[model samples]
Target: MKNKPQYAIESVDHALHLATLLQQEGPLRVSEAADRLGVSRSTAHRLLSMLVYRDFAEQGGDRRYQAGPVLRAAGTSGAPVALLRRVALPHMQQLVARVRETANLMVRVDASVRFVASVESDQVLRVGDRVGRVLPAHLASGGKALLAALPPHELAELYPDPEAAGVNLPKLRRELGLVRKRGFAINDQLTETGLTALGMVIPEPDGRPFAALSIAMPAVRFDRDLLSTWVSALSTAVTATDRDLAAAPVLGQSRGS
Candidate 1:
């Protein structure tokens, strides 16, 4: 057999790592960020300078850094779900206060569910959640609720392997069936032990669901009936938000060519 030429393996570059770090934790100083990334201070400064030139980060007094307005605008401009978050945060806060539990808004990004916004509960034993955390779709109540509203074929395409740990199709289908019947999904320590969650999907005007709302509580504090009540409240809030989104002006229409 003829020998084939070997292709060179590409190494991970500093610029890529720096970009990832900035995306994960913005408003970070060069020295502090360098310490986290295990790179030299000079190297981190250089990377920050490049990011500043590119309008990704802005240097403030005391050498602190914050995400530039351009970055924030880019995140929300053309994305409908991002706009949804901007509009839904107030309602989510109200719901969280009413239910006395942590509230979260999630959307499906590729094969994972990303938290767009969250309000932690005031209780001492609450789940500490934050935005930008991606969780496995199969194991999360928000993910299952969102998946329940997707088209069956699309759902199948997204989860080809039924036995995969995070994207199990069969399990998702069964859970989604239950969600469809009950109008919400429940997570009993599926993401973390002693943390329970209830979630419901918000459907668009065309009846397509692209996002979900969830409430998390300490398992010791809430039982099945209380969880169901929280789920009902979440569903009502999601419905009202969806109506408002459908009525509001589209965000990206003015900026496009």
Candidate 2:
């Protein structure tokens, strides 16, 4: 049987345990954490605060502590995620050069998408770095691109009840269908007013990847007539990135750990 160390450091143990809980069980409230850790609410809060400071935990909109980038990145330690960022940066930079807009690399996180890398345009009106930001999968172009590639059963699993999740199933389905047909997706100020993005899946050979590439720009600068040109640039970057991912030592990683 496993045995605890005789000289165990209780506070260290508690903090580590809390981090483990956040990594494994998703979000947790202060009271819930106290209950799970067998400690008082204040102590639990302190531990969570420390974790947050270290980027191991984050406070969600609902005031629950969830896994932060350090805990959730590439679903492992810094190595795999660093590898992903390394492999995607060059292509992303090229995409930004071609489109003269911001470019982002993201992976699906259940009903959301997390921007892992972003290259901002030189233009003063361009979008900013989106790293570590999360947005609804149905609203973000990269998220929609990744979502469109999932199998139906997996899609249903991710969106059990679209209405309950604040998603319009009928409309989302139509958009995903179009993405499948055209090999890309679009977000015309859906996530933020005056912002628009075009995205395409970054293919992975082993399985469907919850990953994609996108180009974001100010709405006024988005030229509908240039849709083909933007898509072509993103498609080329996605292709090169995908080709590199195929032979990489590290496998593709996505959100939600």
Clashes of each: 0, 0
Q: lDDT for every model?
A: 0.71, 0.80
Candidate 1, residue 210: lDDT = 64
What would the C-alpha RMSD of candidate 2 be, to one decimal place? 13.0
Which candidate wins on TM-score? 2
Q: lDDT tens digits, residues 157-185, model 2? A: 88777778898877888889999999988
Model 1, span 1-257: residue lDDT tens = 01112452222345544554455445678887788558889978887787778887788887787666555553321236546777788889889889888898887765667777778778766776546667777678888887788889988887666666455566668879998999888888887778778888877655566688898887787676575677678977897887777666773232221
The C-alpha local distance difference test score for the whole of candidate 2 amounts to: 0.80
Candidate 1 residue-wise lDDT at 144: 83
TM-score versus the correct structure, for each prediction: 0.68, 0.69
